[model samples]
Target: MLIDTHCHLDDPTLLASLPEILAAARGAGVVKYIVPGVAPEGWDGIARLAEEWDGVCPAFGLHPMFAGLYDEILLTRLRSFAGRAVAIGEIGLDYLAEVPRERQQAAFRGQLRLAVEAGLPVMIHCRRAFQDLLAILREEHVQRVGGVMHAFSGSPEVARECIGLGLYISVAGTVTYRNAVRPLEVVREIPLEHLLLETDAPDMTPEPHRGRGNEPAFLVEIARKVAETKGVTVEEVTAATTRNAVRLFRLS
Candidate 1:
């Protein structure tokens, strides 16, 4: 079985098509999922999804693109989740979007602090802000509860750096693309143990299924690509990545 460590099942599209999405995911051997919240408004939805599904884990945090929605009140509420939240995430810096840099940094640090205080791992979303992301993670001492760099598409050097800081690099469906030069290179350089698989569904649908809404079920194709990149069997990639997720989130 495989675990999709990152998915946005709470999104309207995925939520509206829940039954079909999950059925296809199960058909692909994706037995578990981790859905990350984008803002306070959606936290409850993520929680409800986990409650209704057998193996769905939820995380609460403010996305960089939506940093404007963050406030002290929100941080306090997120902190209250503690053990109930699998991790404090999909949080991190996103320079690609039009949000203010300062607000993103503040929210990222606040959520990172929340994760440390809660003693839970993190699920990070980074885009075009590698150095800034690493700086904050280092200053915050994320080693306490190592997190995963969701949708990681960086060089092998950057991957090694994050690993050194006690973070796992999660590969998404982009790895299945023929022109995915950077992600494929990173996967080849990093060991399977440090890797986690995700579909980042409702967004990056793998090739052959491109133009369609991404879903957890597409995880098998991503895993197959990971196996090919690492020169190993898909079974081995599945076992290692699942163990990494279970250990990182302390999943039952």
Candidate 2:
């Protein structure tokens, strides 16, 4: 079975065809999904989806792209989902975003603290700000409750650094792209034990399916590419990644 470690299933576009999407995913052996929150307004909808679906796991957090929306009110709401959430995330620093770095750091740190307090892992998002992100993660002592670096497209060296801090590097459908030099290198260099698979559905669609709306069903393409890159059987890649996901999120 495969677990989509990161998917925006709660997004309205996907939700519009929930039944069909989930059916296709299950058919492809994508048994579980971890849906993360990007904003306060989406949290309730995510919670409801998790409740209604057998394999839908929910994670609550504010994404770095939406850092300006972070505040005490959002934190309090996130805390309420701590007991049920698999991790605290879809949170971290995004230097590309126009939001002030200070505010993004503040939000990321707050959620990290909450993750620590609740004894849960995190799902970190980072881009062009690894220096600051690493510094903040260390300052917050995040090694205590390690998390996954969601949709990681960083170098193998960066992947190693995150692994050193007890974090997992999650690869998305981008690995299937022929032009994806960096991600392909990462897949070849990083051990499968520290890797997780995701579709980042509704985005990051894999080859042959590019320009189409992504879904968990396309995760098979990613697994095929990872196996091809690492010179392992697809079954091995699937089993190892699924095990890593279960262990990291403490999934049943």
Candidate 3:
């Protein structure tokens, strides 16, 4: 079965029809989904969803895009949530956004520390700031509980570096876009064992579904693209990615 390693099910659009969305996903062969909390306000919802749904798991952190809302107390609160979460995530740098780089870095570092302290894997959200993120990981000596780089859009060289650092490269629905050469190339280069699939649902919908709200059910298209890119059977792609996710998240 397929596993969507990163998605925001708490998004209002999806949360309003979660049962329908999840049923569609199951019908499409999606057996599991990892929902990441994007800010302090979303943490409880994500955690509760994880508790209520056997197929849904949670990751908590402050997204760089939402860094401005963070405070020192949020870190403590995140620590407490980590006890019930599958990972600390949707956390990392995003230089492309208007948020100041320093503030983003500070928030990323704080959450990274919390992830380290809690011994939880991370679900990193990086955008136009791989080098800086890598540097922080190195400086912090972050060797334990490595995690996935969600919607990875880096070069093969960067993919290698992240893999060397004990991280998985998660390919999103973007790979299915006709013009997304780079993400497709990354998929071709990264080993299946180090690869995971995500929809980042409610966004990043694959081709044929672009401009529409993405959902976990569409992960089948992502898997189909990965299979074609790697010249493997769809079942093989599903099995490998699912195993990789289970290993990365320590999910049962």
Candidate 4:
């Protein structure tokens, strides 16, 4: 079985079809999923999903794009519920988009501290802010509980740096794209123990499914691509990634 380390089933796009999506994912060899919390508004839905599905794990954190939602109230809520959730994230820094960098970093730091206090792993979303992200993590000392670099998009050298910061490099459907180079190199070179697989479903749909929104069901395609890149079998990739997910999130 495979664990989709990152997916957004709470999004309205997939919420309505969630049951069918999970069935298809099981048919495609995916049995478990990690649903990350990006916005406070979506926390209830994701929390409810975790309750409804035996295989769904929940993560909560304020994403860079939603800086407005980060506050003491949210932090209190995160502190209250962190123990129940598998992880604390869908959180990190992003410079690619026009948002308040100072505010985003503050929120990221606040959540990182929350994760440390809550004693849970973190799921990070980094974009065009790798150096800053690393700097902040180093300052905040995120290695205390470790984290995952979701939908990783960096060179092998940067990937190594992230690993050094105590993070697992998770790849998405982008690995299957013909134009993918950096992620392919990282996947090919990174140790299997440090590698993870995800779909970032409802967003980064892999090839053939590129035009449409992604779902956990398409995780098989990403895993197959990882296996091909690493010169291993799909089952091997599945086992390693599932183990990675289980270890980081403390999933049963």
- Residues 1-252 of candidate 4: C-alpha lDDT, one tens digit per residue: 999999998988998898899999999888889999888888888889999997998888888999767889889987877867889998998887577899898899999998988888899999999999999999988899998999998889989998998899999998889899888899999989999889998999998788998999898889889899999998899889889888988878
Q: How would you encode candidate 1's per-residue C-alpha lDDT over 95-121 as one tens digit per residue?
A: 998999999999999999889887889
RMSD of each: 0.9, 0.7, 1.0, 1.0
Q: What is the Cα-based lDDT of residue 34 in candidate 3?
A: 92
Question: What are the lDDT figures for the candidates, one per model?
Answer: 0.91, 0.94, 0.90, 0.89
- Pairwise lDDT winner, candidates 2 and 3: 2
Tens digits of per-residue lDDT, candidate 2, 103-214, equal 9999999999999999999999999999899989999989999999999978999999999999999999889887899999999999999999999999999988998899
What digit string (tens of lDDT, one per residue) describes model 3 on residues 11-80? 9999999999999999998988899988888888888898898799988889999998777888888888
Task: Note the residue pairs that clash in candidate 3.
Answer: none
Query: How well does candidate 4 score on lDDT at residue 6?
Result: 93
Residue 112, model 3, lDDT: 86
Better of 2 and 4 by lDDT: 2
Candidate with best TM-score: 2
Q: Estimate each model's TM-score.
A: 0.98, 0.99, 0.97, 0.97
The TM-score of candidate 2 is 0.99
Candidate 1 vs candidate 4, lDDT winner? 1
Give the Å error, residue 138, model 3. 1.2
